[model samples]
Target: MLSDLVDLVLPATCALCHRPGGALCAGCRADVTACLHPSPRPAVPSPPPPGMPSCWVTGEASGALRAVVTAYKDEDRRDLAPQLGRWLAPALRAAVGQDGSARRALHGRGLLVVPVPGSPRARRRRGDVPLLAVVSEAAGGLGGRAVVATVLASTRVTRDQSGLDARARAANLHGAMTVRERQERAVSGAVCVVVDDLVTTGATLAEAARALHAAGAAQVLGAAIGATRRRVLVPANSPGPAG
Candidate 1:
């Protein structure tokens, strides 16, 4: 639909291999799949920032997966949204399913899948919040009452996180996010899964969790499509990097 229209305007090229055809060629898609964990697994950052929620990841954020994420967010590759959503679905399911409290909450209060808010500056530059569409798509595939909520808001501007170490990243994001006042009632006593595109230092997710907890959410779990390999322990059965 929209991807086809966009492709017609600006010929599709694989984000990783630069092959002309689609946002990602079949070969590159296979390589990206190889990066995925055999199953979703815990992704705890070393020296995890305070307020960090229990988190899970679908794949290691390196090579093909990382390139795809960068292109989707910064390089104007909106066509990759469906692929990103599919990749994130497993982690989202695992985050909610493995938590006893989350599973129980599903029957009564329902589930909230909240994407970490994008910066106003970034949104202006990109013309959209790419994570929102992907999060909605993933949550929709959960087959039950998973609701995508844009409840969190960026409270202040922060410096770029690229060069920052764990501590600096935590400091930069501390007090940077808050739940919207109008949405506080919905968040009260809700079980929320705060999701992100990637987990490096985990500062962003921690901040989002903190804000949700402050607003009275009963539980706040975390999920992401990928995580930096150094901070997360990959499973032994996972396949080696793709050729």
Candidate 2:
């Protein structure tokens, strides 16, 4: 709603189609929605890196969906965060429902939604990590079943992942993230859903899970708004209801 008001006062073009309108025009909005899978499904990278938690995604990161994510993250089209979060919510809910720790958290402790940490260099360039707010927005829709936490932090600078292959990406991120000492208690015994705006090689999410598990997280799962079309589907064996 605020984004609409902002757009009204300051005209903006659709991130995907460049049509003059709100952050995304109605037609393009439909196109993005069409990108979403009818149900969230497992999306693992081929040769998934070690510690890659079971993962799910709402859509393929291509065309309108990919364009919107790029605009929101790199082009300063922050207004699109709300829409991205809306797209991400169902995938998150599905991950929570399927993970034993997260399912139990629904009635016992509580689910923790942690955004994968971006590189420090990227933070310096962007001024802030946009995924934090995006994750907060998405987790809010979980009906009090989840709490957003920033437990993971990058331990060293890493190169941009844009041009990296799966192995290179895994090596770049390995040993890059850790749970901040002060926040370790928040992760211990928690059921965490590591949220990322997009998943390309699955290396980033895998690295994030490693840190959380090292911090004593009871279980870790991954959720993303979209994933690269290049993925290996994990067999459907979880008992949780499909999204």
Candidate 3:
């Protein structure tokens, strides 16, 4: 198969250390950290610009999760996405369970998994949308009849969020997203789970939740492979300030 050929030519290796084996070597994979059982929280609500999709945040963000996500997104390491997704699968499933307990709850329900659309510039530079791939892979691991939909599009280009503080990152994304009208039907009345590689200040995910709700998604849940920790500041008069 073509996929086998591609794998043959470009063997899988640990994205962090280039150790040959699976997508990641056992040791290196172990090094990739995760935050287990993050408490679910509502996504920070933003004002709808008249007829926008509803959105909600669902997990606590942590520094270790953010680091792994950053390594995957900024480092052009697609191989790591699946591994990261696998690690986060349990948490994602739990979040879904919280919404309902019905059997086949997610089956044939027209669940649309819309990853936060990345900027064209970042996609071009990275060679692919890592978050989309990761979410798709995660869906596969879910081992159910849930369908994954990719219907949203980034209508405007924006600057990369890397290296920017949370405030700046949020400002950079305002009004930078809009769903394609033709693809709007894919999300209508469906349980739309907004996927992202990571969440920091949550501005990006918040905006994405808004766009999906505007598209008529029945319920919008924000899910990321990892959450980012906000930097803490220490006072100048602290007893033991670092040199």
Candidate 4:
């Protein structure tokens, strides 16, 4: 497989299980795959983070998934971008709602994928928004109708979110982002899908939605690689169908 070849050349090792082969070996990928569902599911943060937008996730953020996400976000695994980006594709497709009719509509209307902004501090530390590459890759697979746009920017400095509970997370991110004035014209009337690497309290996605809506976006949906299952509330114990 192509991934296996890349693994060999890069001397890859599994970020989760540490198996020597790929950043995520086939076994760990299967673990993530088992939880992936094509349909968009609601990710309501417990206590419900205010301003949180509706979101679809590929898997619960735990075990191998969580470890891999951490490695990508903090451990300088930029090479893992393609692999993680592929993992994020289903959720992006789910957010786009690819039923026959919806697919045709999307092909005509075009899709704009926007990554939720990371703090400048984190951006400097990590070199970029880790989810941007993933979103770009996912957008590439959407034919010629979709494009990745980095339009949101943090409006102020926010503290590290690691120790925060749901409430604190909400407080930390509320009104912390904005759509650039230059991008507002482009955002207007666009079907924007907010992309993120992980969703814990849903604060970040919520904030992204708020910024997009404020800029005149026609509609917004969220896509993520994983979300905290314990924190999110999905309907009917099943992934919700369509966006």
On residues 1-243, what C-alpha lDDT tens digit does candidate 2 reach at each position?
A: 786587678778888788787789999999888889999877777777888888889998888898888888777787788888999988998898787768788667788889987667557755546698789888998875688888888898899887889899999989999999999988988889999988888899999999999999988999999988865556688566664
Q: Across residues 92-171, which tens digit of lDDT does each residue of candidate 3 receive?
A: 56456656521244766545667777668667865435477777777675555556666666767778777876567667
Model 4 spans > 4 angstroms off: 1-10, 17-19, 34-40, 98-105, 231-243
Give the TM-score (vs. native) of candidate 3. 0.72
Q: In order, what lDDT does every prediction score?
A: 0.88, 0.85, 0.61, 0.78
TM-score of 2: 0.88
Question: Which regions of candidate 2 are displaced past 4 Å?
Answer: 1-8, 231-243
- On residues 62-123, what C-alpha lDDT tens digit does candidate 1 reach at each position? 98899999988887677798989999999998998899888876656688889998767667
Residue clash pairs of candidate 2: none
Kindly state the number of residue pairs that clash in model 4.
0
- Which ranking of candidates, highest lDDT first? 1, 2, 4, 3
Which ten residues in a row are the worst by lDDT in model 4?
Answer: 97-106
Top candidate on lDDT is: 1
Please give the lDDT score for candidate 4: 0.78
TM-score per model over all chains: 0.89, 0.88, 0.72, 0.82
Ranking by TM-score: 1, 2, 4, 3
Best by TM-score: 1
What C-alpha root-mean-square deviation, in Å, does candidate 3 show against the real structure?
Answer: 6.2
